[model samples]
Target: MDCKSESGLEMQNVCIVEDDDAVRDALAELVESDGYRVLSYASAEEFVAGADATQVDVLIVDFRLPGMSGGELLKRLNERGMRLPVILMTGHADCDEVGLGLDVQDVSFLTKPCDPRRLLGLIGAAVDGKG
Candidate 1:
């Protein structure tokens, strides 16, 4: 069977839930450059409503959001049984506290203004189900 989707998109897709347009676009560009499909959302609600859990290989979310935070979103995804790998980005000094007990698997945190290489590496790891 072919791995690509019916739309001819790559099989591996990364869902980015970020409210910041600049940050979201930059992440999407970087992810796409690595040959993976990118699905970006302005809010966790939008992501949850629009994204297909089965199609997403990994999730990249911002710690702070307009309504539901990244941790809350992670919990929501878990409740839906979509245990995709996750990466959380934030500028909050206590971002770790916000994500203390998320129920998802293979989760990692990235501080805001994260190094491009680090972000790429983290995404690569998540895609491979390692981190």
Candidate 2:
């Protein structure tokens, strides 16, 4: 995508780091429909390598992946000083276990098959600095 708003201005960037192809694609569609520029990756490692972590306005990531978990990615980003709004999701029952001791601000959690309205609301809040 061109990452531009309808008014010919630059739009906010939202990144999704998910290993599941279907989940990632669906999330990208949802986020894009909300008018944010969406950048997606299949793994935390791919996201770390392919995109600048500091530039994205918000990050929506899966808590569990084949390689590095979402919590680890958040920790690594924190260590690198890239604090931003994050929405972490997972199908596992141990949702509370994610992002326990991370210094990143504006963090929210969502279970798998999350409500689109709630997700969009969180994204809006994050973008508006209310998260």
Best by lDDT: 2
User: Using Cα atoms with residue i matched to residue i, what is each candidate's TM-score against the true structure?
Assistant: 0.86, 0.89
TM-score of 2: 0.89
lDDT, candidate 2, 1-131, per-residue tens:
35567898878999999998998999999999988899999999999999876678889989898898988988888887778899989776766677587655568888988999999999999989933
Q: Go through the candidates in order and give each one's C-alpha lDDT.
A: 0.82, 0.86
Quote the positional error of residue 105 for candidate 1 in Å.
2.8
Among residues 3 or more apart in sequence or in different chains, the pairs in candidate 1 whose N, CA or C atoms overlap within 3 Å are none
Question: Can you write out model 1's per-residue Cα lDDT over 1-131, one digit (the tens) per residue?
Answer: 23487787656778899999999999999988987778889999998788787777878999899999888888877887777888888785856476566744568888888888998898888777632
Residue 66, model 1: Cα distance from true site in angstroms? 0.3
